[model samples]
Target: MSRAAEAAIAASYKALKEDFVSNLTGGEIGEINYVTAVAPVALVLWSALQTRQSFFKPYTPLSFAVDFLLNVCAILLATTLYSSTPIVLNILLLAPVAIIYALPRPPLSKKPKVPPPKTKDADAENPLPKKPFLTIYRGAMLVVTCLAILAVDFRIFPRRFAKVENWGTSLMDVGVGSFVFSAGVVAARPILKEQLAGKSTALSTRLYKSIRHSLPLLVLGFIRLYSVKGLDYAEHVTEYGVHWNFFFTLGFLPPFLALFQTAFAYIPSYAGLAILLGSVYQVALEFTTLKAYILTAPRTNLFSQNREGIFSFFGYLAIFLAGQSTGMFVLPRKLSSTATTGTEQRKRLVLTLGAWSGFWIALFMLTTNYKYGLALSVSRRLANLPYVLWISAFNSTQILCFCLVETFFFPGVYKATTAKEEKEAYELATSRVLEAYNRNGLFVFLVANLGTGIVNMTVKTLDVGSRGAMGILGVYGGLITALAVGLDLYGISIKM
Candidate 1:
C-alpha cells in the first residue's frame, strides 16, 4: 500500500473512534427512570418464580440458567432491543407472567412430615437478620454496569442512554452515580461502627488501614491508564479527564474520608454533614471560578489534566457520607413483634426509606426547576448538587422497592420456622447467580472490562447489526455468568 493511503486510513479510523462517543446530550428523565425500573421488574419476576415448587426447585443447573435469563439477559435486551420502549409497558407484560407463576399450587393430599432442625446452625448463630435486598441491590448495579460498559460501543445501543458530555441525565449517568452511591452504602457500616463505637485508633493506623484497603484499586487504576495509553485505545478524555479513571476516584476516596473519621465520631449526623458539604460545594461552583476551571481548563498539568476527577471528589465524598447516614439509619433493630408491633415496625421502616427517597427526589426536581429554584443541571462530570440528589433518591427508592417486594412476595424467606425450612426458603429467595456477582463483584467487573476491551479490539462494534450485537453481547454475558457461577458453586469468593 502507498504511504499516503496508509496515513489516510489511520486518520479515518481516528475520526471514527472520536465520533462514536462524542458530544452526547443524554436522554429524557422519564426514559432513564423507565429503564432503571427494569431491575425491580426482573426482581419481581424472580421472586415469583422462586416460590413455585413445580418450577426449578432444589436449585438445578436449569434453575440457574433461568435465573441468569431473568436477571441478566432480560436487562441486556431491555437496554438494547427495547431501549426505546416504555418501562411501564415492560412491567405490564411481566406482571401477569409473575402472577401466573406466583399463584399457589393445590396442596398435597397428605402433608409432608416436618424435618428436625439441623444441629449445626448458621442463621441461628448469626443474630442479625439477613438483608437480601442489599444483596439483590448490589447485584443489580453490577449487572447494569457490566452491560453498559460494552453495550455503549454498539450502534443498536441508544446514544441518549450513553454518558453525556456535560449536563443531563442518562442511563449510563445513573449507572455511574448508583455505583458510587451503592459503594457508599456498603462501606457505611464499617465507618459507622468505628465512629459510633467511640473507639479511637491512631491516625497513622487508620490511614494505613484505609490505604491498604485502597491499594488494589489504585494499582488497577494505574494498570488501566497504562493499558489504554499503550494500546492507543479510543477514549473520551472528558469522561474522566486525560489520565483519570473511575478506579482512581474510588481509590482516593477511602484515605480522604479517613482524615475525617475522628471528627465524624463526634459530629453525630452523617446526613447533616453530607448536606453541608454538598451545599458548600454547590455554592463554590455557582459563585466562584471552580466551575469554569473544571469545564474549560487546558490540560497543562497533572491536576488540570485530571480536574474532573479531582474537583468531583468532594461531591462524591458528600454522596458517600449520605450513604453512610442511610446505612446507619436503616440498621435493622431487633424489634419484638406482635400483630400490632410487627405491622408498625415494618411500616415505619418502609415509610422512612420511602420518605427519604421522596425527599431527595423532590429536592432533585426543585434544584433543577427552571422557574422556581436554582435551576441547576445535573452533571456526572461535575458531580454537582442535582447529580448527588438524583443518585441518592434513585438508590433509596430502589432499596425501598426491593424491601417491599421481599416483604410482600417472598415473605416466607424471612418467616421460615425451622432450620430446614429456613435453608430452603433462603435458597428460594436468593439467586445463586446474583449472590456470585455480589460476592465477586469487583473481580467480575475486572473480567467484564477485559472482555469489553477484547470485543472492541476484535470487532468494529459500531458497524455491528442489532442481531450481530446481540449475539456478541450474549456470548460476552455468558462468559461472565459462567465465571461468576462457577466460582460461587465452588464457594470461592475472590475479594481484593
Candidate 2:
C-alpha cells in the first residue's frame, strides 16, 4: 500500500476506536451489586471443593482449571452472557451445592489422629496474623481488572460496563477505584507499625522512603505515556487526559499521603482526612467553576491538557485514606493485638467491617439522592465523593463476604492449631492461584498490560465474532493465570 493509504487506514482505525468508547452511560447500581457478588461466591465454591477433598487439589492442573473457571470465566459470564439475568438469584439457586461441599466430612477411619508437636515459647513471639481474606479480595480486584482491560476491546463486551464518559458508575470504573483503595489498604503498614513500636525516624528519611517506594510507579506511568504515543495506540483521552494515564494517578498518591505521615499515628484520622478532602473537593466542584473547567476548558497548556488527572488526584487521595482507615480495622491484628483469641477476633472482624461497609453505602445513597441530599452523580472521571464512597462500599462489602466465607468454611484457619493443620486449612480456605497473583501482583498486572498491547496490535478486535473473542480471551487469561500459579508454586515473587 502507498504511504497515504496506510495513513488513511490508521486514521480510520483510530476514529473507530475513539468512537467505540465514547458517550457511554454506565449500568444501574443494583446490577453492579449482583455482578460483584460472583467473586465471593467463587471463593466459597473453590474452598468448599478443597475442604471436601474432591478431585480439586492445590497447585495441581485440576486446581488451576477450577480457579480459572471460577475466577476468570465466571466473571466473563457475569459481565456479558448472564448480565441481563438476575445474578444473585443464580447464586441462591446454587447455594445448596456449595453448602454440601462446605459441610464437615466424617473421618475415613476411627483411628486416633496424631497429636500436635509442642515447642518452647514459640507462640509467644506474637507474629502478625495471616489475612487470607484480604489476600483473596486483592486478588479478586486484580483478576477483574485484568479481564476488563482486554475484554473491553471486543464487541461482545457491554459499553455500559466500560468507564463512563463523564458521570456514571460501571464495573471498569469500580475496578479502577477499587484498585487504588486496595493498594491503600497496605500502603501505610510499615509506618503504622513503626508508630505502634514508638520508633521515630527523621522527616528526611520518611520523605526519601516514600519517594523511593513510588519511583517505580512513576517510571511505569512515563513508560505507558511514551509507549502509547509512540505506537499510536488507541486511547480514550478524556478518560484521564491528553497525556495523563491511570498509572500517573496511582504514582502520585503515595508521596501525597506520605506528607500526612503524622496522621498515621491514629487510624481514625484517616477517616477524618478522607471525609474532609472528599467533601471539600465536592464543594469546589459544585460551588466553584472547577467542575465546568474540567469539563469544558481548552487544553492549551500542560496542566490544562491533563486537568482530569491533576484534579482528580484529591478525590483519589480521599479514597486512599478511606482504604487506609478500613485496613487498620479489617487487616490482621498487630503484635499487641495478638492477645485476643482467634474466635473473638473473628467476631469483631465481621462486625466492624460490616459496620464500615454499611456506613459508606448509606453515605453514598444519601449523597446520591436527588430529593434529600447533595444529589450528586458518581463520576469516575472526576473521582468525586459518590465515586469514592461507591468504591469503598463495594470493596468493603466484598471483603466482608470473603472474611465470612473464610471464617465459616475454614473455622480452624484462625484458631490456635498445629502447624500442619493450620497449613492444610489455609490451603483449603484460599485459592493457590489467587495466592500466586497476590504474591506478585505488580508483575502480573504488568504482564497483563503488555499482553493486551500485543493482542490488540495483532488482532482486529472490533471485527472479531463473539466466539473468536472468547477464544482469544480464554487463551490470554489462561496464560496469565498459569504464569502467576507457576511462579507461586516455585516460590518466586517478582517484587520491586
Candidate 3:
C-alpha cells in the first residue's frame, strides 16, 4: 500500500478498535458509535462515485485501478484483523471505515439560491382519495388469510392433515404469493399515479424515486446475466449467487412498497398492527413442530412440502407493509420555504419514534432466534415472521443510520457537488463502499458462498495437515475479502 493508503488503513483500524473498546467497557459513547457504523457504507459509496467520475477524466483507468487496490487491501486487513471476533462485532466494525470515507470535504464558499416550489395546474385532478377504515381492515385481513393458509401447511390445521410434506408445499405457496403480491403492486399504475398527485399522500415518494432511480441497476443485471449465460463465464464466475438475486429483489421492493403505502393510507397505526400480527404468528410457529418441519425439508423440492403456503406471504407482506408504513411517517422531508417550522419538527419527531421502534424490533429478533445462521439464507419457508422482522429491522436500521448521519453531520454534502464533480474527486472513494451494496449485493454474497464452497471442494483434494489447513483457511479469508472488494468496485454504482 502507498504511504497515504497505509495511513488511512491505520487510522480506520484505530478508530474501529477504539469504538469496540468503548462498547466493551461501557463507555458513554453516543454518536460515535453511529458515526463508526456508517463509515464502511460511505467509503464504498465514495469509491463508486470516484470510478464513475473517472470516466470523464483523463486518468480514469488509473483511478479505477488505484481505488480497487486500496479497497482490496482495506478488505484484506479488515478480514484478517476481525476473523476471530464475534460475528456481530465484525459486522459492526465495518460501519466506521465506511463513514470516514463518506465524510465530506471542506465546502465551497459560494451558496446557491434555493428554488421555489412549482405551482400545480388547477385542472389537474388528484388521483388519491380518502378510504374508509373497513377498506384497510379488509386489505389487512386478506394478508392475514394468506398467512393462515401457510399456517395450515405448517401443521396448524387438523391433526389428521398434518404432515412434513405440507411444510414444503406451504413454502412454495408463500413464495408464489410473495411473487404475486410483488407483481400486483408493480402493475398498479393508477394507484401510484393517484398517490403521487396528493400533497398529503401517506406514501413515501423517495421509495418510488429510488426505484426509478435504480434503472442502471436493471441494465447491469441484464448485462451480468448475459455475461454469465452467454459468455460461459460460469466456469470463471466467482461471485454468482450474491450478485444476481439482490438486483431482482430490490427491483421489486419499490413498487410493492408503493402499493402497500396506498393500501394502508387510512389505517392510523398500520405498522404497529403489522408487527403485532407478524410477531404473534411467528411465536406461534416457533412453539410448535413448525420449526423442525420447515428447516429440515428437502432443499431441491421446496414446493413439495406442506410449509409452502400463503402465511409466508402474509409474513413478508407484513414486513413490506411495515417498511412502507414507516416510510410514510418516518422519512424526513427536504426543507422547503413554504413549509412551516412546526411541520419539520413534527416530521422529525415522527421519524424519531419510527427509528426507535425499528431498533427494538431488530433487538427482539437478535435475542429470540437460536438459529442465527438460518435466517441469513434465502429460503421463503425460512422467511417466517421472525425472519421478516429481523431483516426489516436490520434494513430499517441501515436506512435510519444513513439518514441521520447524512442529515445531521453530512448536510449539503450531495448538493455541494455536481454529478460530474462528484464523479471526479469522490467517485472511487464513495463507489468502492457502495459497490458492496449496489445491484450485486446478492452476487457478492454468492462469491462468499463460493469461497466456502471452494474450501469444501478442496478439502479432500488438498490433503493438508491441521496447521497447513489453518494457514489455508487464513489465506481464504484474505482472498474472499479481496474478491468481494474487487467485485464491489467493478460492478457497483453509488447513489447519493
* Local distance difference test scores for all models: 0.79, 0.79, 0.39
In candidate 1, stretches whose alpha carbon ends up further than 4 angstroms from where it belongs are: 1-24, 54-56, 92-95, 98-128, 192-202, 331-344, 414-424
Number of the top-ranking candidate, with TM-score as the measure: 2
Q: Per-residue alpha-carbon lDDT of model 3 for 150-200, expressed as tens digits? A: 222221222221111212112222223333332232233333455466644
The stretch of ten residues in a row with the least summed lDDT in candidate 3 is 129-138
- Give the runs in model 3 whose Cα sits over 4 Å from its true position: 1-81, 85-194, 199-270, 283-289, 295-314, 326-332, 335-354, 357-381, 414-496
Instruction: Estimate, for each residue in 198-231, the C-alpha lDDT of model 1 and write its tens digit.
Output: 8667889989999998999999999999989998
Mind sharing the TM-score for model 2?
0.89
User: Which window of 10 residues has the lowest lDDT sum in candidate 2?
Assistant: 119-128
Error of 3 at 54 (Å): 14
Report how far off residue 67 is in candidate 1 (Å): 0.7
